[model samples]
Target: MILKPVPISAEQFTPFGDLIETGSDPIAINYGYTERHHDLASLDLLEQEGRPIVSIFRSTPLPQPVTLNVMERHPLSSQAFIPMGNQPYLVAVAPAGEFDASKIRLFIVKPGQGVNYHRGTWHHFCLALNAVSDFLVIDRSGKGDNCDEVTLVEPITVDLSDCEESTAR
Candidate 1:
């Protein structure tokens, strides 16, 4: 099956998770030097001795016509990925619960946007586009195996033909 990605938005992505982006009504803080987009995502940790851990994931661009054969989920806590640079990326996800390949959805995340997958939401890893990128990853760190992976019976091909030519490569 071929999957096409659409632009990421809070409304459309709410079922799977939160869309981390700066809203128009940001609060001015630090003597007006900083604008805080407060409470963008709800971190669902603290289950089964689960604690939040922050890390940086450096990712390289995927090969053209990206194909995904596996999906993973964090059953114990939510996972958030914030890009450290002004580059676009792709997000592939499915709703929490039974692993249904047909329920998968793709999104094109532009610069200045990030994503927070709700606990147990099935998703693919960071998909950097154009060049190497770094993402600030926030997720759970504790016992009882938070991650679960499932290999797809049929690989899904992500079609980038509709995306901007520059980033599609």
Candidate 2:
């Protein structure tokens, strides 16, 4: 299976989850001192939830045309990834329920865009395209089995050739 990533847009990504785009207009508050893009995503967490965990994930860049063998999902909580730098990255996802190889959708996110995967949304791990990138991740921290994984019977080749290429550092 070969997968080519598409540029991310809020509407196209709506089915899987929210695209917390920082590039959009913000709500000015506190006497115009603050710009807030409020309530962008619904953090649907498990009833027995632990405090949300905030951490930095620094992912090394991957070369273009990489092979993807696995996908995973967190059943207990939604996950958000906010890029700390203005570098493009890849996001691959599939809808919940029995995995369908044909249903997989790949997104190429530019800088200033963040993503929130609804609980149980099947997705690939972060695929940084440029220099080592850091992401601000917010999600459930404690208790219960939160993850499920599936190794593809046939690995998918992720090709970023059509998009603007980046030098990996």
Candidate 3:
């Protein structure tokens, strides 16, 4: 039960891949007043390894777009995303140790950035608009199924919520 929340930046994402691009687009405010453009980019990371092991891919992502209901938790794994095309939307779930209304955050994987999830870390699925979101994922892979879901007692609004309490940490 630990709530150590930190940003998965270039230094942290390096072990997973290389940062070579950055791009962005604008996201409008609700009142139809203020508008802000976001940056996105493409990135490449070479993860060297021994003999034949995990499969290498151009952009293999989760088949199903995780339609998150509020936020959820995974008791046994951490998930990571590396934005390859457009900017990525990062929502997340958390263990009680890391759960705090003032702490949970979202990360924008601007085109050139990517990430590697530590084991048993709670997270949200990928969020991207316009073009396809791509990434090189590194995680435990096996024939056996590996997924567990836990609904939160209270749901959190992803698109519409208080500005301060929600965002990538």
Predicted candidate 3 versus true structure: per-residue lDDT over 3-104, tens digit per residue = 222344655444333333333455777787966544432221222321112333343232333334444333333344555455444434343345444444
TM accuracy, model 2: 0.91
lDDT of 2 by residue, 31-131 (tens): 99989988888877654656688889999866656788889999888999999997888899999878887899999988888999988899999888868
Give the runs in model 1 whose Cα sits over 4 Å from its true position.
165-169
TM-score for each of the candidates: 0.96, 0.91, 0.45
lDDT of 1 by residue, 1-169 (tens): 9999998889999999999999989999999999999999999988999888999999988787789889999999999999999889999999999999999999999888999999999999889988899999999888888999999999999988888853654
Which candidate leads the pack in TM-score?
Answer: 1
The TM-score of predicted model 1 comes to 0.96
lDDT of candidates 1 onward, in order: 0.92, 0.85, 0.41
Deviation in Å, model 1, residue 68 alpha carbon: 0.8
lDDT of 3: 0.41
Give one clash count per candidate, in the order shown.
0, 0, 22
